[model samples]
Target: MSLRPVVDEHECALHGDCAEVAPQVFRIDDVAVVIGTGPDELIMAAAESCPSVAISVIDESTGEQVYP
Candidate 1:
């Protein structure tokens, strides 16, 4: 299944860890943004790596949260 990544702008600290872990999926500007759809593994990794826990991965089909 595919996963979609989202960044919580309020919680984001501009740490850039998410982008570092999954550059193809995340980009950092004034804040982090989802640049592309990523595989579940990569999305989870990026979400887990977020220092502020600002990233989340959701299952596209089930709408279930896959990562914190």
Candidate 2:
């Protein structure tokens, strides 16, 4: 299954950890951000690595996140 990256601009600190983990997926698009394709594990890592917890992941098939 595939996943999408939901970035919380408010909580994001632009730490670049997500970009580091998955450059192809996350990157610094100007002062803001941009993300690309990935899976749950990569998505989770990117989200968890965010010190501000600005990144969120939602499974496409299941249509669920790390929430209810």
Candidate 3:
């Protein structure tokens, strides 16, 4: 299964924790942005590390939310 990472701009705090966790997938600017995809583990780590809980992981095949 492929994982996609998404950042909620409204909830983002510019903490950059997600980028630090998965730089290849997420970038920090005014807010966290999804740049590209990485391994599922990396994506999940990034989402979990977000201090604001602004990052969410989705199952690309099922379109289901995988993480909070």
Instruction: Report lDDT per candidate.
Output: 0.88, 0.74, 0.89
Each model's TM-score? 0.91, 0.79, 0.95
Model 1 clash pairs are: none
Give me the displacement of residue 28 in model 1, in angstroms. Answer: 0.5
- Which segments of model 3 are wrong by more than 4 Å? none
lDDT tens digits by residue: candidate 3, 1-68: 89998888999999888888888888888888899989998899989999999988889999999888
Report the Cα lDDT for residue 46, model 2: 76
Q: Which ten contiguous residues of candidate 3 have the minimum total lDDT?
A: 21-30
Native-referenced Cα lDDT, model 2? 0.74
In model 2, which residue pairs have backbone atoms overlapping below 3 Å?
none
Alpha-carbon lDDT of model 3: 0.89
Query: Which lDDT tens digits does candidate 2 get at residues 1-68?
Result: 77778887877777888888877788866433655686668777877788777887777788878621
Per-residue C-alpha lDDT of model 1 across residues 21-50, encoded as one tens digit per residue: 999988899899888876778888889999
- Relative to the true structure, candidate 2 reaches a TM of 0.79
Q: Over the full model, what C-alpha lDDT does candidate 1 score relative to the true structure?
A: 0.88
